[model samples]
Target: MLKIQEIREIIKLVDNSSVDEFSYEYEGSKIELKKNKGTAAPAPQMVQAAEEVKQPAQQAVQQAPAQTEAAPVQAEESKPAETTADDANLHKITSPMVGTFYKSSSPDADAYVKAGSKVDESTVVCIVEAMKLFNEIEAEVKGEIVEILVKDGQLVEYGQPLFLVKPE
Candidate 1:
């Protein structure tokens, strides 16, 4: 059975993705998610089957994605806005998925980029680990990094700003 936090993370991923439906089964437990047309996020259903022949299986419809939305809201509130007049020409490098931010490929390695670091469209600026996959994030714009928006190991939401770059 999946833990509550893990389930929430899965729900967030499904919500942020374009998939219309998703299903997973493990042991006797199953999870299903289907997106509602015109809705921004999908609703998930969790099912647990009892091993004992005499006991009835239990099914639950979980609508906790609304609660999960609050976490990202709080995170955004705590993050200082980068849209000041001086930063108007700066470009933002945003996370494409929800994950843990890693400044380096490994803890002992030097950070991929930092403040004042120059980068091109293909430069791997950092990594975002999602569901055990470390996605190398590219700068996508030629510029000098002006700031590192999120700290190492921080939980980042989909489309959250990860870096600020001053375009060349």
Candidate 2:
């Protein structure tokens, strides 16, 4: 359980710093502070209530777009060689979180999908590994892969475009 003074201090630290999120653990209690002015804070009561109040703030920070400005520029510069003349025809499958983009199931395996491969909603196009968990990323829209937007082994952030596809 976190004391009100501790929560206030955490909030103050968050406001004073440029950090988007701050987490601390002490005496078996955890404190997580997030920057999200959009979320309304609940009137502080029990520790459980404070945690509930903080949920939206944490979610917003986790899902926010402002954190990805740097990655998109890099991804844009590294657009695959095969992506030409069809800029308007492409649809993108983007990363949902910060993770390592993997082209194949493993180093020796073939890529799950490649340029010119057709994919449907259920197709597992690739994997994005975060915190040692391999996440199978799907093609949400049916399309032929026109270009892959990230290099294998590259670090990708939330909402970063991963593939450019020509929708069927």
Candidate 3:
């Protein structure tokens, strides 16, 4: 889930940073933390070092309000986009997790895949970050990314369409 480096960075921030309790507010998710130099820290630290994560552990603690607020924003944004749906011959590529979708590895970087780009079963389409885990989602079929169903950093539902692929 979470990459080792990202976790280590968080841990280092907690351990070395004076902001013992830091929070990040995204589109619809709010991650809050209350670091109590206790036993919980060790296990989380170990878990963080073992994987390359995309989200923060504090996500679970603060996602409720954020999720509620985000719903309306996405709903409004999808209105115009849904019009493109009339071209239903395309296949929908949905998300496997309830997390934030990242189109690229980092900010200011190009997306991993884009509309009109051809892809194969082994091609990585995007990354989903959930509870501090950065999971990679690959194209299961050989096709072209005809449309991106969801916006980058948007909270996606399990099985929610992320892209529209026109198979080759």
**Residue-level lDDT tens digits of model 2 in 48-84:** 2344434422332455454555666676666555554
Q: What is the C-alpha local distance difference test score of each model?
A: 0.70, 0.68, 0.62
Sliding window of 10 residues with minimal summed lDDT for model 2: 41-50
Best by lDDT: 1
Best by TM-score: 2
Question: Model 2: runs farther than 4 Å from truth?
Answer: 1-64, 77-85
Residue-wise lDDT of candidate 1 within 8-94, one digit each (tens)? Answer: 568779878998788988876666667687867544544444243101111124324565466545545665675455556889787
Task: Using TM-score, rank the candidates from best to worst.
Answer: 2, 1, 3
Residue 13, candidate 1: Cα error in Å is 22
Worst 10 residues of 3 by lDDT: 41-50
Clash-forming residue pairs, model 1: none
Residue 133 alpha-carbon offset, candidate 2, angstroms: 1.0
Q: Across residues 1-168, which tens digit of lDDT does each residue of candidate 3 receive?
A: 333234335645776766657654444443344466654322221212222332343333234544534544564466566545544576766665468999998899899999889999778899988876677787878999977877889887544678778888
Tell me model 3's lDDT, rounded to 2 decimals.
0.62
TM-score of each: 0.55, 0.59, 0.52
Put the candidates in lDDT order, highest first: 1, 2, 3
